[model samples]
Target: MDKIINSPYNINAVARVDSDNIVHNHIYHYCPIGRVDDNNFIYDNNNNVVGRVDDDGIVHNHSINNSPIGKVLENGFVIKENALVGRVDGDNLLLAGAAYLLLIQGNR
Candidate 1:
């Protein structure tokens, strides 16, 4: 059977992404108020929201997965392997494998 994932903010509403790696929009019955506590914004392997992130960078609330939400690094590149990774110098999320690899080349 297919697994059903629910957003921690809303049970009736669901989060949907427009493109595969582009725009991500969340549609729910009512707007979620309050801040997203890190502890409450955990996610699962299936990308389910198991927790939330508050105004401060604290993971107290419980959620699905504990993947680091928000910006992982500041003005640095996200390197997965030993390659040239894209630079995060701007306000855009770069998904280039090689580019991200290059960014963290000499950082280590």
Candidate 2:
């Protein structure tokens, strides 16, 4: 089953996918960039390393530091710093799904 990541305000759809969104407006599909590691990497449709999400819900840029950019809390709240940024509708959303909303869609 696919999960739709809605805007924090609950107005627009940030992402619609199970692992990657396929909507026509969505130019990029968020998916696992490589082999599953300690941190799951998020890649765009073009296959570039976009960011990563850790088991603890820490979202990181594609860098060695994996600096904290945002977080996907256990309650399905997507946070940037300390602000509520997005929300996932439905359960069991994979790390990549949350990462795309915060790291990619949030920027748009």
Best by lDDT: 2
TM-score of model number 2: 0.70
Model 1: per-residue Cα lDDT over 23-68, one tens digit each: 1213322222122112333333345444433333222223324443
| Model 2 misplaced stretches (Cα beyond 4 Å) | 19-39, 63-65
The lDDT of each candidate is: 0.27, 0.63
TM-score of each: 0.20, 0.70
Q: lDDT tens digits, residues 1-108, model 2? A: 666677777657656654443322243433332222234676665666767777788888775466788888888888987898787677644445667666665446
In model 2, the Cα lDDT at residue 46 comes to: 65
Query: Which runs of model 1 end up more than 4 angstroms from their true locations?
Result: 1-47, 50-73, 89-108
User: Candidate 1 — worst ten consecutive residues by lDDT sum?
Assistant: 16-25
